[model samples]
Target: MPISSAMAVKASSRINSMFRILWLSAIVGMLAACGSVPLPPEPPIPTAPSAPRGAPPLATPEDGAPLPPARIQGRTRWQPVRWAELPGFTDDALNEAWNAWIRGCERPVPALARLCPEVRQLSIGTPEEQRAWMMQRLQPYRVEPLAGNESLLTGYYEPQLDASRMPTAAQQVPLYRPPADLATRRPWYSRQDIDTAPQARAALRGREIAYVADPLDALALQIQGSGRLRITEADGRVSNVRLAFAGSNEQPYRSVGGWLLQQGATRDASWPGIKAWARANPQRLNELLWSNPRVTFFREEPLSEFDAAFGPRGAQGVALTPGRSVAIEKDSLPYGTPLWLSSPGPLLNLNRLVFAQDTGTAIVGPLRADYFVGWGDQAGEVAGRLKQPLALWVLWPR
Candidate 1:
């Protein structure tokens, strides 16, 4: 939804008004024809199209809500740039991004729906041809947030962990399902409340979906939203199943890593850092967990070999494509929007075409994005370590 420009909006308002008037005039004209009744005086000419090339670069209406100004920046702004400005535009494989783009097409936003056919037709093109097609059909808009020249780029992934079907002495921690009273109450319970309050525990009794041996592992799954659980049942059979997002307690989220920083306990504010702290202060683990009031609940999904390669469903209801799918502020960059990203040496892959396919609560503000690394421990390792500055350019329809 790369916010609309002022000219486009003014144009759209006039268009809407014109449509209404036409509808009304057609009704009145039919009546006049039948009884010789004079038509109402003609409405003043529709707002004149901008003179001196006054029209906005584009005037297409968006999907649902009226979008904010896109051509200009307030908190986050887009400025037109040439495709040549994009680093590795031709060098990168557009095919690598094609699948992610197709995933977005599974549920295209209205403004992007028209482009779906063309996207499907071009999916099989060579990287060079695809590059040329993008250069011709899309405009590169350099994005910058109001406060800074660049925004932070972080990573997140699906975690794989060992699990048990039921609570055991060795595997005592529990993963819960939403309770029936969840619908009846607002902000049902906080993380601290769930751990310490008898009432909260009572509410969640008999709702365990699975149990884990490590408390931190459970928290990690909650923070990541979803993951794959390798279950080891009493019968000695093990199978991998996905724990997808079900619901969350209606409580405000506080980053445990952020809380650690405020207490002057750390500088490296990543998952690994949190785990390191947990290892050293084993007794105070609950204190750290309680710092984050919000708690997330999940439901188990069967994972097939094919499904294991992709990520859990995103806000757009499409499985996230590792390395290519990114979570952006939909109000700023609509899902399915293609972005040309450039980062300094510190980032793993500096430049690539990433599709906006997912979103997260922590991923707020303009020009901000979270890169999905993929599933398993390698992905998690990369995600936890990422904290770098990034530059982004949206490849919007020309």
Candidate 2:
């Protein structure tokens, strides 16, 4: 289903406003470097983007949500650096990032947990105040990968799709929860087996949570590991829900995008390109999907108005802040560590503060990060196309 017109406008306006601030800051930095004038008052802090239409709101720390254990910081080298080494440090809207930091505090590493009370008070503080607190209490360290490879940045988003409570001619593809024997089978059925093997089908019988129209949509949701679903019930009532990652078939993931490139099937392997290829070659769609052996299962959650403001809970067990939350290789950085992320972008030039609040299977290495771009088609477009060189500096507690 098409996004509501109002949502499109709000998303567009938010993005445009963010870019404008970045552009203005760049000019201010250049002017200060030239000694042309003193720095102007800091740019207004941008507020969080509105939740997608009908999307659930975010839950807060006050909700007393259970959290996963924080991962240990990895063996990556941290070359201590002066705060001056961080680009755009002064220009970043710390108040904007404070929201992510606040979320990170929910499951903060032990050392950082002690600082949460102050972090909470700073939520309403000014950029200067937040920046001062960070500079005073945190030590900056440049992240150096053990492998000595250039750090790469990619993007992922929570896919949003329409669904039906039961299968229909148009919405025949089903998204399943873990099968009854999901745990008993080590390395459960592959994608092809779930479709072709009678035993596999039997296990998944009556297990579908919802049905989507397009197989590709199901695949996208699986790959992302979570998604938002706008569901139509048997009684014609509509509701929005989330599909959170529960378990996965133990088979290793294979990139269907990579497979497409190998076959010279299409030069553009992003979702839009893949969908275009599918439209032209419907007969080969199953072959394309089965190239990825792994299959993820999910559990459904109701989307309440209170939980609608944020993205789904991430690996860290906190709702992700659209532009501020990132999935890191736990071996590279611990969950809830703040960092200065500098990426000279072909898609977007980003020099900002972000938190390591999530992890992904493909996100490995010291320099690697998968930026969470949020939910909806606009965010989806950005996430699908973003793959850039990244530089990181960990901001650790002193």
Best by lDDT: 2
Q: What does each candidate score in C-alpha RMSD? A: 12.8, 15.2
> In model 1, which residue pairs have backbone atoms overlapping below 3 Å?
1-334, 3-70, 4-68, 4-70, 73-77
**Tens digit per residue, CA lDDT, model 2, 194-265:** 999999999999999999999988999999999999999999999899999999998999988899999999
Model 2 backbone overlap count: 7
Judged by lDDT against the true structure, how good is candidate 2? Answer: 0.79
Q: Where does candidate 2 stray beyond 4 Å?
A: 1-73
In order, the Cα lDDT scores of the candidates are: 0.75, 0.79
Candidate 1 — number of clashing residue pairs?
Answer: 5
lDDT of 1 by residue, 1-398 (tens): 12234423333434333333344344433332332223233334233244235544324333133333458544667877545567776568788887777667677676666555455545555565455456445667888776755578899999888889877788889999998799888988999889889999999999998899988888888988999999988788898899998899989999889998999988877888889998988888898999988888999899999678789989888889999988888877888788998766564857899988888999987877899999888888889989887789987875
Model 2 CA RMSD to the hidden true structure, in angstroms? 15.2
The local lDDT score (0 to 100) that residue 170 gets in candidate 2 is 90
For every model shown, what is its TM-score relative to the native structure? 0.79, 0.81
